[model samples]
Target: MSRNASASTRIRVAAGAAVLITVACTASATALDRSAETRSPGTPREAAALTGSAKLYRPLGDDITFTFDAHLAAEHRMDPAKATGTFRFSHYLDGRGAWAEGRIDCLLTGGKVAVASGVITRTDLPGAQGNRVGFTVHDVGRHDRLGYSWASVGNPVETKDLPKCVSAAPFEKVKNGTGDFRVLPWDPDFLKEG
Candidate 1:
C-alpha cells in the first residue's frame, strides 16, 4: 500500500509540472504574437519594412557632390493606388574616403507609375554639421507587373542642405502614405547563381 501511494504521488507531481510548463509556453507565445501584430501591415509601423539595394548620384550644391550605394531595410507600404515607406540607409560614399548613413520618408503615387517625395536626413558633407535634405523621386517603374519593385530618378529639393546637427530624425506628424512598390521575399539565391 505504501508503494502504491508513493507511485501515485510521483505521477501527480509529474503531471502538475507538465501542466505548468504548458501554461507558461502558451503565455509566452501570446506575448510574441501581440508584439508582431504591432508591426503588421497597415498598423502605422513606420510605413513599411523592406530589404533592398539602391544607388543614387546627385549634386547637393554647386561645389558638393553626393553619391552612394545604399543597402537598406526600410518600412514600406503598398496598395492598389499608392505606396510609401520610410528607410534608414547605410551609405558608402563615392571614393571620398568617407561614409554616411541617413533616413528618408518616401511616398509614391499612381501605383506602378508614380512620383515620390520625402524629407531626407544625412550626415553633413563639406561641413561637420548634419543636414536635412528634401528629395523627389519621379518616373517610378516597377520590375514586376503584378508587384511593387520599382526604380526612380530623383534630385534634391533644395540646392543646399539645411543645417540640422542631429544624428537621427523621426518622421514628424506623418502617419502613412500610399503608392506601389513590389517587395520580393528574401531567399538564398546567391548560392544558386554559380
Candidate 2:
C-alpha cells in the first residue's frame, strides 16, 4: 500500500481501539452502580468485612442518634455494600438507644458501607477516623464485602473490648461523618427512664 494509505488505516485502527476501551470502562462502572441499586431496599447496598456476631464499627457520637431509609443499589452478594440512605441524624438516645432526629438523602458510597434503617447506636459503636479509618475500612470492606456493618454507638475508641484507634481521639478534630474502628462501648454512665 502507499505510505499515506497505510497511515490512514493505522489511524482508523487506533480510533477503534480507543472506542472499545471507553465502552468497556463505562460498562464496568454501570454494572457496579446498578448492583448497588438492585438489591432489596432493606438489605445493605455496598460491601464490608466482618462475619462474627460480636462485630464492631466506629461510632459517630453519643450526642446524636440516627435513623435511615436505605435503598440497596445494584450490587453483588456482598457485605458492607455501599447503601443509599435518606434519614435524619436525630437526637441523643436519652442515654438509651435515642429518639428524635433529622434525615437527608445523599450518596455515601466508599469502600465505606453501613447497615441502614435501624437504631445505629444500638447496632454499632465507633472506630478510628481520618486516614486510618478510611484505609482500613476500605481494605477490609473490599476483601470481605457483605460481612460487617457501618454503624456506631458513641465513642468506639473509648470501648475496652477492642483496641484503641490511636493515641488521640482521632475524630476530635474533623467533626461529622467520620471516626475510627472499634467495638461499641457500653456506657457505665448510661441512664434510662421507666
Candidate 3:
C-alpha cells in the first residue's frame, strides 16, 4: 500500500510541474505579442529603420551642390502615410550656402531606393520657409545617386505648391568619394546587384 501511495504522489508532483511550465510559457508568449502590437500598431512586426547622408555635387557646375542628412523610422501601421524622423538639407550655389532643418514627414522605400519629404521649420534658404521639400537616394555600392525636388520638379514659384515627397528619379551620380547614401533594407537579399 505504501509503494502505491508513493508512486501516486510522485505522479501528482510531475503533473503539477508540467502544468506550471505550460502556464509560464503561455504567459510569456502573450506578453511578447502585446509588446509587438504596441510597437508597430496593427502590424505583426516593425519595419526596419532608415538612415543616410550625402553631399552630392550637381553636374551642371562644380560649385552647385546639395547635401542631405536623414534618420527616418519605420512607418507605423496606424499612420501608413507618414514616417517620423529628422532631415536637414543644404544647397550650395556659387560658393553661397543655404540650409533648412525639418522633420521627415513622408518616406517611401523599395530595394535600394528611398524617397523622403520634409517641411522646413527653420531655414536660411529664401523661398523655402514653411514649404515641403523632397529628396531621393539610390544606394549603389560604388556609384550612388541623389536627387533634389527643387531641381527635379523644377523650382516652383511657390515652394508650398510642390507635392509632398515628390521627386524625379535619382539621375545625378555622386561626384566623388566624398558623397554616398545607404538604403538599408530589412532583408539583405532585397538589395539589387551593382
Candidate 4:
C-alpha cells in the first residue's frame, strides 16, 4: 500500500480506540452515580470517611436537655459484601454546667447499630475537684445517615457490674441521642438542623 494510505489507516484505528475507551469510562461513571442515588435515604452514604459532631440528650419532661458534644469518625461502607468498618469517637458528657470527657473505639454492624463502650471522667467537680473520676456506659445507637440516629434508652451498664470505670454515680435515666452524618456542604443553601 502507498505510504500515505497506510498512515491514514493508522490514524483511523487510533481514533476508533480512543472513542471506545471514552464510552466505556463514561458508562462506568454513570453506573456508580446511579448506585449512590438509589441508596436508602436513611442508610449511611458511601464515603471514604465521614466526620461529624454528635449531641447527646437527656429527656427532662417536656424539654430535652443537651448533654454533650461527641466527635465521630467512621469509615464508609459502600459494598454489601464487606464487613462494617471501625468508628472512633471522643465525647464530653455535661455535668449540669460542667462536663466530663470520654473516648470510644468500636466497629459498626451493617452501618446500622454500634454498641460502644467508653469512660467518662469528671474533671470539673469541687474539692478533689478536677481530680474527680467517672464511669463507662454501654451505648447502643443506630448510625445516622441523613437526619437520624439511635442511642441507649435507659440505664446503661455501669462500672460495678462490668468494672469498666473507677466510680459510679446515681444519675438520671438517659433517653436517646438523635444524630446525623453530613458532608460539609459548600453551598449555604443546603444547610439543615444537625
Candidate 5:
C-alpha cells in the first residue's frame, strides 16, 4: 500500500503538470498567432479552477512553448480546431525551468472519445530533457485551424545561447488567459511525420 501511495503521488504530480502545459500551450499558441498578425487577442479570462485540481496558471511568453506547439502539428496529430484542455503549471529548476501538461476533456463530436494531453518540460533553464514541450492549435487560415507541436530547448532567440529550434516570435502574451487548447482523438504521433 505504501508503494501504491508513492506511485499515486507521481501520477498525480505528472498529471497536474501535464494539464498545466496543455492549457499554457494552447493559450500561448493563440497568443502567438495573434502576435504575428498584429491582431487583438480573444477575450482573456482569469484561469478559473480547471475542474477541482489546484493548478497554478501563468501566461506563456517564450520560444520553448512556441516550438513544442508547432512541433505537435508537425509531429503530434493535434487538431487545431479542437485540441483544448485543462492544465497545471509548476516551477521547475528553481525558477529557471518550467513544465506543463494538457488533458483532453469531453467534447461535442458526439461519440465517446479517449482523453488526451501533452507536456512541455525545459531544462538548463529549459526543464527536463534540456527542452520544453509545446502544444498549439493553429489557424490554417480560411477560418480553420489545425493543431501544432514543438519540443525544444533554450529561450526565444533573445538570449545569445538560444538554440536554432528556438524562436520567441510565436509566444508573446500581453495578459493572462484561460482554458488551454482543445483536443482531437487521432493518434498524435502520426501528425509529426507529415
Candidate 6:
C-alpha cells in the first residue's frame, strides 16, 4: 500500500480501538451500579438506623402522670458498641416524682416503628434497678405513640426475662406538643466506607 494509505488505515484502527474501550468501560460501570442497587434492605449493614428522641406523657388516674424520655443513637455499624444513648422514665404524682435512668443498648427500626432495649443504671421503681427494659416507638405523624414491654406483659413483677429489642405495639398516644421520635434510614451513598 502507498505510505499515505497505510497511515490512514492505522489511524482508523486506533480510533476504533478507542471507541471500543470507552464502550466497555461504560458498560462495566453500569453493571456495577446495578449490582449495588440490588442489595436487600434487610441486610444488617443496610438496615435503617434509629436516632433522635421522644418524650411523652400519659395521664394516670388520681392526678398522676407517667413520663418517658428516650434518646437514641444507632448510626454507626463500624463499631456495634457505639450504637446507644440514654433514657429516662418517671412518674409524677402530687409534685413528687420517681424516676429511672439507663443506657440504651439494642435498637431495631423499620418504617414507622422502632424497638429498643436498655439496662437501667439507676431507678427508684421497685424491682427495676439493673434490669433490662424494652420499648417500642411508632412515629405516626401527628399521632405518635409508645409501648413498654412490661406493660404489654401485664405489668408482671419480673421483667428481666424479656428479650432484647422486643416490645409491644405502640399504644400510648403522645399528647400534642409533648415530643417526637425519628427513625432514619441508611443512605448507602452517605454511609459508604472508604
Output the number of the lDDT-best candidate: 3
Off by over 4 Å in 2: 39-194
Q: Count the backbone clashes (under 3 Å) in each candidate.
A: 11, 50, 0, 1, 46, 0
lDDT of 6 by residue, 1-194 (tens): 99999999999999999999999999999987776676644444334444444456555622222333333332353333344667666656677756777887766665677777778888877777877877777778766888887875544236777666777778777666655666654333345687
Go through the candidates in order and give the C-alpha RMSD of each one to the true structure.
14.7, 17.4, 10.7, 15.3, 21.6, 13.4
Q: What's model 3's TM-score?
A: 0.61
Best-performing candidate as measured by TM-score: 3
By TM-score rank, best first, the candidates go 3, 6, 1, 4, 2, 5
Model 1 reaches what TM-score against the true structure?
A: 0.31
lDDT of 5 by residue, 55-132 (tens): 122345332221112112212233432433443333443346554443332111211122223333233333333222
Per-model TM-score, in order, reads 0.31, 0.23, 0.61, 0.27, 0.20, 0.57
Instruction: Name the lDDT of candidate 4.
Output: 0.34
Query: Can you tell me which runs of candidate 1 are displaced by over 4 Å?
Result: 1-13, 25-48, 51-96, 107-118, 127-194
Candidate 2: residue 133 lDDT (0-100):
15
lDDT of 2 by residue, 1-194 (tens): 99999999999999999999999999999997897677765555333221111112226554542223443333533322233333333234346542322121112223343322222222222332121111111213212222211224343333233221112211212123332222111111123243
Give the per-residue Cα lDDT of candidate 4 at 68: 22
List pairs with backbone clashes in candidate 3: none
Error of 4 at 134 (Å): 12
Cα-based lDDT at residue 66, candidate 6: 32
* Residue pairs of candidate 6 with colliding backbone atoms: none
lDDT of 4 by residue, 52-156 (tens): 334434343333222222222212232212222222222334523333343322212223322222343332423222221222222333333211111232222
